[model samples]
Target: MIFWAIFGYLLGSVPFGLVITRALGLGDLRQIGSGNIGATNVLRTGNKGAALATLLLDSGKGAIAVLLARHFGGETAAEMAGAAAFLGHCFPIWLRFKGGKGVATFLGTLIALCWPVGLIACATWAVTAAVTRISSLSALLAAALAPAFAWGLGRPDIAAAAAFMAVLIVIRHHANIRRLLAGTEPRIGRK
Candidate 1:
C-alpha cells in the first residue's frame, strides 16, 4: 500500500501541463493566466491542442496509478494510490508543492475506481459547464456530487475517497470561489 501510494504520487507529480506547454514553446505555464499548471490554464494559452493534451495526461496519471495499483496490490492499495495521485497533482514536489487544482486527476481516479460514479460525475460536470460556462464551478459541482453518487451506488470506500479529493479540490479553488461569489470569475472562453 505504501509503495503504491508513493509510486502514484511520483507518477502524478509529472506536471503534464507545464511539460506540454514548454515543449510546445507556449511559454512558462506558471507565468500564464492564473499562473496554474492545469488544463484550464493551459486553455488560456490559446492552444486547444496543448490544453487537451494536458487534460488527458493529467487525468491519465491518476487512472494509471489506480489501475496499476489495483492490479499489483489490491482494492485498498488502489484507493490509496488514487488518493495519493490526487494529492500529488495538487501539491507536486517538483514544483515546490504548488500544482494543479486536482479536478482532472480526481475524476480520473474516481473513474478508475468506480466507473459508474465517475461517469455520473463527468456528466454532471458537462451539464454544469454547458449551463454556466464556468470551468471552476463545473468542476466544483462535479466534485461535490461524486461522493454522493458513490454512496448511492453502495461504494462507501469510493465515497470516502471522493469526499477527500473533493475537499482538497474545493480548497484549491478558493480564489475562484470568491470570484464566483463576486460575479467576477471568468467564463470558459473569455480572455
Candidate 2:
C-alpha cells in the first residue's frame, strides 16, 4: 500500500499542464495566468488544445493512481492513494513544489473512488461554469459537493478522502476565491 501510494504521488506530480504547454511552445506555464499548471490556466495561454490535453492528462493521472492502487491493495489504499495524488498535483516537488489547483485531479480521484459522486461533481461544475462562466467557482462548488455525494452514495472511505481533497483544493484557489469575492475573478475564455 505504501509503495502504491508513493507511486501515485509520483504519477500525479507529472505536471501535465507544464509539459503540454512547453511541448507545444507555449512557454513556461508558471509565468502564465494565476501561475498555476492546471487546465484553467493553460486555457489562459490561448491554446485550447493544450488546455484540454492538460485536463485529460491531469485527471488521468489521478484516476490511474487510484485504480492502480485499488488493484494492488484495496479500497483503503485507493482512498489513501487518491488523496496523495491530489496533494502531489497541488504541490509537485519537480516544479519546486509550485503546482496546479488540482481541480482536474480531484475530479479524477473522486471518479475512481466513486463514479456516482464523480458524475455529480462534474455535472455541478458544468452547470456552474455554464451559468457563471467562472471556472474557479465551478471547481470550488464541485469540490464542496463531492464529499456529500460520496457519503450519500455509501462510500464513506471516498467521502473521507474527498473531504481532505476538497479542503486542499479550496486552499489552492485562495487567490481565485479572493478575486471571486472582490468581483474580479476572470471568466472562462478570458485571459
Candidate 3:
C-alpha cells in the first residue's frame, strides 16, 4: 500500500497542463489566467484544444494511479492510492507544493474507486455548472456531495477520503470563495 501510495503521488504530481502549454510554445502557464495548472487556467491560454487535453491527462493520471494500485495491491491499496493521488495533485513536490484546485483529479479518483459515486458527482457538477455558469461553484457543490454519496453507497473509507479531498478543494478555492461572496467570481466562458 505504501508503495502504491508513493507511486500514485508521483503519477499525480505530473502537471499535465503546464507541460502541454510549454510544449506548444504557449509560454509559462503560471503567468496566465489564474496561474493554475488546471484545465480552467489552460483555457485562459485561448486554446480550447490544449485545455481539453490537459483536462483529460490530469484526470487520466488520477484514474491510472488508482487502477494500477488496485491491479497490484487490491481494494485497500486502491483507496489509499486515491487519497495519495489527490494530495499529490494538490501539493506536488515537483512543483514546490503548489498545485491545482483538485476537481478534475478528485473526480478521476472517485470514478476509478467507485463509478456510482463518480457518476453522481459528475451529474451534480454538470447541473450546477450549467445552471450557474460558475465552474468553481459547480466543483464545490459536487465535492461537497461526494462524501455523502460515498457514505450512502456503503463505502465509508471512500467517504472519509472524499470528505478530506473535498475540504482541501474548498480550501484551495479560498480566493474564489471570497470573490463568490463579493459577487465578483467569473463565469466559465468569461474572463
User: Candidates 1 and 2: which is better by TM-score?
Assistant: 1
TM-score of 3: 0.97
Please give, for residues 79-104, the per-residue lDDT of candidate 1 as tens digits.
Answer: 99999999999999999999999999
Which residue pairs collide in model 2, if any?
none
Where's the lowest-lDDT run of ten residues in candidate 1? Answer: 182-191
How many Å off is the CA of 96 in candidate 1? 0.6
Model 3, range 61-139, lDDT digits (tens) per residue?
8889899899999998998888888889889888998989888999999999999998899899999999999989999
TM-score of each: 0.99, 0.98, 0.97
Query: What digit string (tens of lDDT, one per residue) describes model 2 on residues 44-114?
Result: 99999889999999998999999988898988888888888888898888987888889999999888988
Candidates in descending lDDT order: 1, 3, 2
- For model 3 the local lDDT of residue 168 reads 96
> Candidate 2: misplaced stretches above 4 Å?
none
Deviation (Å) of 46 in candidate 1: 0.6
**Local error of candidate 3 at 9, Å?**
0.5
